[model samples]
Target: MVNPRSSSSYRLRRSRFVVPPTIYRLALILLAFSVFLFLVSQRQIPVFDRGPSLPQKSSELEERLWDSASGYGYRPCVKPTHKYAGIQKSTGATDHMFSPIENPKSERSSATAKYFLCAFVLMSYTLYCRFSPIFNFLLASSHYICDMVAVARLMNATLIIPQLDKRSFWQDTSTFSDIFDESHFIKALENDVHIVSELPKEMESAPRVRKHFTSWSSASYYEGMSQMWKDYEVIHVPKSDSRLANNDLPVDIQRLRCRAMYYALRFSNPIESLGKKLVERLKSHGPYIALHLRYEKDMLAFTGCTYGLTDIEAGELKILRENTNHWKMKGINSTEQRLGGFCPLTPKEVGVFLHSMGYPSSTWIYIAAGDIYGGETYLSDLRSQFPNLVSKVHTESLATVEELKEFAKHATQTAAIDYIVSIESDVFIPSYTGNMARAVEGHRRFLGHRKTINPDRKGLVKLFDMLEKGELKEDTKFSSLVIDMHKHRQGAPRKRYGSLPGSKGRDRFRTEESFYENPFPECICPTDHH
Candidate 1:
């Protein structure tokens, strides 16, 4: 209003000072590029560009496969190459040699993501007792410990090395480090969860909440549990078994379970060395069958299966069961237990089953068991059929005699040796589906689905009874029936079974197949997929 020319000059000056839209756009683009470069430099963002291409030659491909199989430059717990190629060929199991489809680099990143949040806040701690009194067997304890690792990861908390149970049935005072390679366990799971040898000095007196997580809890249950971090610096789990549900978990978490079980929980150096030595000795001979004959006095007493035992032996088993405070059901009917297929096969029945399966008398058999109920008295009939039957006590090499003697009294260590041999055997057979059998069968599946024969006890009991009553004979028809009955029982690549139909609530979890028994579609993938 004062002067048009002056106003126009002012406008022109203001326009010169103002930035153009194009320049603003260009500046924003540069700023975004700089931020992206910074993130790339810090590895906050993963580059997707194909860097070094994989070798295309057939020989190079073979080398690549071999390297993956052998787990070169990887952790010691990385799955080993299938060593029973001869057995695989004989059993037509060549199709199961594919490597796990997980991308290791991505897995590391995902595992890091799980705990990165805790790095920002006050670091929380998780301390758990690995061995519960109820499930204190070596393999059972191992499974529970693996579950504890998964729980620590789920809570985004650092896990203190778990305390083993010395007060359990075994009454062995083996510490965690005494049985497991503690350093290897820590290093292998470094990316997945923080594992310290013990609580930090500052956390020794920190306020902690002792929790006994409900068995077979879902992931959401653990997520709710992590909320405890706000009130307590440490969360101590009194028991660890079955804390994680069998199914309906994230793929990463399920895979983490596999990583913990298959790759982190390595046996101590002494145990592994002796176990491998025994395996080598057995492999030096022809192929052998590992028969996990669970006919020990303790098992018979616990199951109340005194069938085939003398009257005095039955009395002894009954008295032992009644005296055992932990074994709750003291008045179990032996006939009902046997009819329900809850009893382990007797040694004589094992002989008949194997002979019926067409295993010749000359076949090498390794009995993977502890002290039998009646020793050679009960085993005489089985030994008579399979003359090559042997056990760790009889198969010790000269160099390992003293070493074996050192582990003779420690049931856990001896069981570890049997576990190794059973997993490596040409065929694995369990007389009872106990913890060790489930663990071994699962491990064998992980190792390329090696042959594991799960005998149908319920089905076989009928045949056994008929033969005892002179109603049946061990003929070609019997062999065909035994073989045909087990056609689908062999370890095969399949998805884990879910809870039984109509199973609801927590009972459903109990009915579902054990994750340790079959980790498929999560840790395992078809060769066609990557």
Candidate 2:
């Protein structure tokens, strides 16, 4: 005990300086906090190496901006490799399964398209026949009906059921029902506008105004007509074609036209079933080609194509062209027409074009048209090259004429078959840009811009003329020229504004575009959804 104080000091100094439990925990927590702060300060935190995290709001805005830069809205161009690539279906209940848009809630009430609108005025006599609508191709006639419905909607009038033309070549006495499913048509467009099987008894006696709606009429014209509805109970629309202005119509009307044509318009059950069967039959042999060879007798006579015709046949066509009073151009020069490529491509030319374009001989070519002007004799050349040419006519022959007697009764029905097959084909090539061709091309564009090789007829004609003069060979030079010429016209995606811009005031109606003929990037989208 001699040095107690010194001993205590020595002991205290020797002992380890242990930290308190609370202080130890606090120190560990502080160390972790420092590490976390370091990470937070850095430019990137490597969470799965997915790059810098975006604040949710800024990311969405950036994505939208990127999409806007691309031609269409938010959605990117559909990847070619995606499933259901290029398949287009109607947005109708009967055909919605085939719709390009993936709408899985078919059974759900919310899945259906809806509209809220009041019923408008009803005209007892809309004058379906007084105007004498043009007796055009099936598609053209269908477009007329679409415009008619659209016009009816615009006029705020109840549309009397339109009568199908009985004066056509096939001359089937069947009403609209024979070609299209009537129930489907009414149901499909129920929301857009009021359609009636027949004018109501009360409205039947209503004062009907026999008014002739002007062609390519704009919204103002229809508005004027609506005013007449007060004075006259019904405003009669004599002419159906170009009645509604293409561009001047409201967006709702334009979309209604599309809905009416593509969705509301459905082929009869029998025709639809047969069309699908024929398509499957053709595809069974692998990818086939659908060629709208506009070489029908009327076409040849109209265009004055004496290319591969005999002197008698040429003389006959000339006579037909001259005699036809409706044909504005009487003195059509066949040589000049062919040289300018205004005439339809002959069978031989089609063969050469397809061969040059790398389609093998084994390729299945389906001819989509009424009848070749010269029949088998003319199509022999194409047959010699492709040999696998098939058409609805060919397929129809498979069934006994007795079995298809009712089906064959109407040209419109047969045309329906041709349309379905052509639409379903992997490749569609049209020789001429007539109503049907343009309609199909536009439909294809609306679908997904499937490969519709609208052959550069004018350009090819020049090359062919040079070849005839021995200036070009049938070798790589010819193949290369054909390929290079058709680069743009191969159904590539493009933007389309209604007609050329520059229409002022009411004249703008004149520039109104055809919906089915040039839907372009507007009615179309890269994705399956609207």
Candidate 3:
């Protein structure tokens, strides 16, 4: 017979290796849960499948098609492609859809809902959050506002009207509605992106991610930024300037930027009325040139260019620069700055340049600028050359004068008035390449390539230096040199310049021409297309 002790040891070993029923039950539960999770994930994930064909109602198709292309994660709605479908009969629908003037309505009809539902189902897994960008820079720079709006679209987020930075250098407290027509901005851009006046009540106190996006960022950068929506309902951008790349953005995005800048961003009713009134008064006189002369105390202090200033004045600017907390670059070499063409031309230099430009003394010159740094001391020179120099302060209408006086301390409102006048002028000239200058130049391009003489500051500076040393004379030779130097610089249709030869990474974007400065091939189309 087998030994009893050995049999008992074998039974004990078998018992030690046996798995409990509870463990098997727990594993079955986990497997089932994992399978359920996989199903849920698949259902929620966005897929690139061709869904059912959209309905063929022309207006409905147009609305849905635009919405699909408007960062809504949907394949573009295709029109009937039969051999004799006569798509061209729509009369410039495809060609003009990208135009800033084109306002495509977002319909809420049943057909639109069906298409939207289809898109939503496909993109159910994608999360869209609300973006609230606080514009901490100059509100006068409309391009910054446009860039933020385009950023909102890129993020696929509902945009609450951006809050203006009242603490900026201007120190003027102006709300969004004070400078822009808020309702018009919202309503006009409804078809492209959702915009609300403020955050929802529930979301007002919710946790938000304050993001300072990388400067000159590409669209993919923002796509990656959207991942934060998983943890936060809102993304707050601290600063909005130069947040979008100048080039390499999608055509629709660039077109959206154009639409927002040109069509949607209308000035406030009071500002617009006053601005138009000033424009009318200006036009009544004759063709005038809007001269954006950026020679103010702040500009000088910020740039640290004390060229042409008296010793005492330069000292004052130096003190101001040192005292300003935000201005980082201190102790700038004024001589180097001037030689590098970073300084705004002095009033005398401007007068000399204009005189050389063939402009007669009788030509109307509207000065679009803040107070000259040295007041009449510096302005007398430019005035002596162009006797017809005028500003908003010189308007003849008492009512208009009183209205302007009401907006005296408000720099943005006043700047808006100047912008209107500048854009409508027969010719636009900027002595400095500031925000307003670039914006007006691009806008003039949009308005059928208007005459804008962007001064060659570097070349002109060299000439000015030569003239100062008595090596150059202010004769036809000088005039011809100036004219020829700017022959191709005037606002004309040309391809936007790309990055410099050796630029790499983000520097490439920084070096490229700003889209707002020249949105040529994207927003501006060829004549034959029309």
Candidate number of the best lDDT: 1
TM-score of each: 0.77, 0.73, 0.74
**lDDT of candidate 3 over 1-530, digit per residue (tens):** 99999999999999899879999899999999999998887676432122112223545533321111222121111111121111011143211111111223445434433443343333321222222222212333467667777666655556777766666557777777888899999888766666777776766666677777888888888868757755776777665457788888777678778888888899999988987887777678766789989898888898899988899999999999999887789999998998898998888888888777666566678888888898889999989878778887754641356677778777777788788888888789898887788888888777766778888888998999999899988876777788678777777678789999999976788788878778887887654443
lDDT of 2 by residue, 492-518 (tens): 677655555787866765554565776
Off by over 4 Å in 3: 1-141, 394-400
Residues 125-232, model 1: lDDT tens digits: 555455653432788888888888777766756678988767777777777887889999999976666678887787778888778889988777886786786778
Best by TM-score: 1
The model with the greater lDDT, 2 or 3, is 3
Q: Sort the candidates on lDDT, descending order.
A: 1, 3, 2
TM-score of 3: 0.74
lDDT of each: 0.74, 0.66, 0.70
RMSD of each: 28.6, 22.2, 31.2
